[model samples]
Target: MMKIAVIGTGYVGLSTGVCLAEIGHHVTCIDIDINKINLLQLGNSPIYEPGMEQLLTKNIENGKLLFSTTHKEGLQGVEVIILAVGTPQGENGAADLTILQQAAKDIADYLHNNPIIVIKSTVPVGTNDSIKEMLEDHCKKEILIVSNPEFLRQGSAIYDTMNPDRIIIGSYKKEASEKIQKMYSPLNAPVLITSVRSAEMIKYASNAFLANKISYINFIANLCEQVGANVDEVSMGIGKDKRIGNAFLQAGIGYGGSCFPKDVKALLHTSLQFGLNASLLEETIAINDSQQELLVVKALQRFGSLNEKKVALLGLAFKPETDDMREAPSIKIAKQLTKMGAEVAAYDPAAIDNAKKILGDIISYTQSIKDAIKNADAIFIVTEWKEIKNIELSSVLKEAKLPIIFDGRNCLNKTKIMECDSIEYYSIGRPAIIKK
Candidate 1:
């Protein structure tokens, strides 16, 4: 088994380190956060991901996984170093690589042998080269840098890592590429080796394209509503054509979480630096940003004004099975609804703690769906969690006073929802069922 060090303990690092260990690699995850390292020492995960903590606990018990608070501890005796530090968005929309740069310098100081440095974090193009140049001044040996961008989803990151769509290894040297290729050989997936720049661009391009599809479908859904057409049917009809496969075609409040929003903005920033006007990418972001307010517009039309209206928000996290609220539509909607003098009762099974940090003292937190919907005039469906989707409309109507339901994710069954005469159902790209 190859010895490796993953330098970061966020969603990307923890998941990567644990998965590599599960695949028979001896991995030591390094982070600057002592609290995070202590939590990992106790076989616990700081982030929410399906099947993540279990794998972490199992791998730790099997002596395959290790955690540390410094690179000096984790990098020693390791042959491969995967840089997975945070590249948070800056004020000007560019990816702030302060943490990544710090990690690279630290690795250079702590390296015991010449090793392959894999860029697993989502970064701007040419960041791999930048890291190499920075490392060269500090290290005496020839350092091999590989742009191995990870494409794991937030909720199912473990499953996605274990079963990746494609494994990309971007390296300048042939020896570096082959060595990195052999490292991931056990995955047995389709591996693509290319230049460093292409690999870095691939991550941004892929996220931008996925975000484009969501915006495209949402725009179509809005048109469908205006023209009395169904977007679900349209998506199904078009998806049958192999050229336009129906992934990310769900008509909703738009894409959010860590990847799409950050990557799109970072790419736009990069384009601006080169004097390239990326009009399509700019419009894609505009469409998504506007989707957050569409539900409020629908509510405004139905109620005239949201003055002291009790509103129930079914989901707080951006999506289901994840507690990540970064750029979540629910936060925007909650703030908007509250600004309009509406009382919002927000609830999410997993993200309540994280949501509490953002929506503190603004919206009331609810423990159950019944509590959230109790005496509510309007209910806004945000995330399509199984618990929220399985909520009975009739039961909800009993607790709600007026029972005007705004289905943001189209989570509920329309047929069953329509049968409830006491409830009013409104969803994106679908015909509204108004209770007369």
Candidate 2:
């Protein structure tokens, strides 16, 4: 089994390290945050992900996983160092590589055994070359850098890591590429080897394309709403075509998460940096920014004003099963509702604590879906958590004073809403069921 060191114990690093250990590799995960590392040492995951903590505990018990706050201990005798640090979006719409660069410097100082460096973080094209140059200069030796971008989704990260659709390994040396390929041999997935620049481009290109599909479907959903055509049917009809596959076709308020928004903007920034006009990418971001406020616009159009109205927000996370609130649509929706003089009681199965950090005391937090919808004039289904999606219409109708529901994610069952004639139901790309 390969001995691996993974820097930055965020969602990607922690999940990757845990999964690698699960596959029988001895992994040490390093983070700068002592508190985070302390918690992880005790077999507790700092972040929320399904099946992550269990694997973490199991691996710790089996002597496969390790956690540390310093690079010196973590990088010792490691065969591979996986860089999974954050590349947050900067004020100029470019990815800020400050953390990644810092990690590289730390690794350079502490690394032994000439371990191969694998970059699993999303970066702009040519970033791997820059990182390689930086590391070689610091170490005064030729260092192997592999562009191995991660494609794991947030909520399902554990599963995605273990069962990836494909693995892309980009490197300058065949030895480095083959070693990295053999490391993932346990996964038995298809591996594509290319140049460092091409592998870097693949990550941004993939995220941008998925973001484009979400925005495109959102545009269609808007058109469908105007013409009374069901977007669900339209998505299914087009998805049946093998070429068009239906992955991101679900019409919703928009796509929001750590990856899509940052990667799309980063790609647009890169395109413009090269003196290329990327109008489609620009529009993709624009559409998503607008779509996040659609439910508010709908509420405004229906009520004319939101003065002192009590609105229940069904979910606060960007999507389901994770507590990541970065660029979450709920942030925009909550701000808009509060600015319009509405009282919002928000609920999410997992993200309430993280949401409170971003949202503050502006909106109330509820423990249950029932608590969120109590005595509300309107309810907005934001994240579509299983609890929110399976919420009894009878409970909403009984608890809510007006029984008005706006489904931002289109998670509610329309047939059930139709059966309950007293509740008003509105969803993305679907006909509103309003009772007189």
lDDT of 1 by residue, 60-132 (tens): 9999999998678778888899999889999999999999999898888876588889999899998999899
Per-residue alpha-carbon lDDT of model 2 for 214-284, expressed as tens digits? 99999999999999999999999989999999899999999888999999999999999999999999999
Candidate 2, 331: how far from true, in Å?
0.7
Q: Could you tell me every candidate's TM-score relative to the true structure? A: 0.99, 0.99
- Give stretches of model 2 more than 4 Å off: none
Q: Show where candidate 1 strays beyond 4 Å.
A: none
Clashes of 2: 0
Q: Number of clashes in every candidate structure?
A: 0, 0
Global lDDT for candidate 1? 0.92
Highest-lDDT candidate: 2
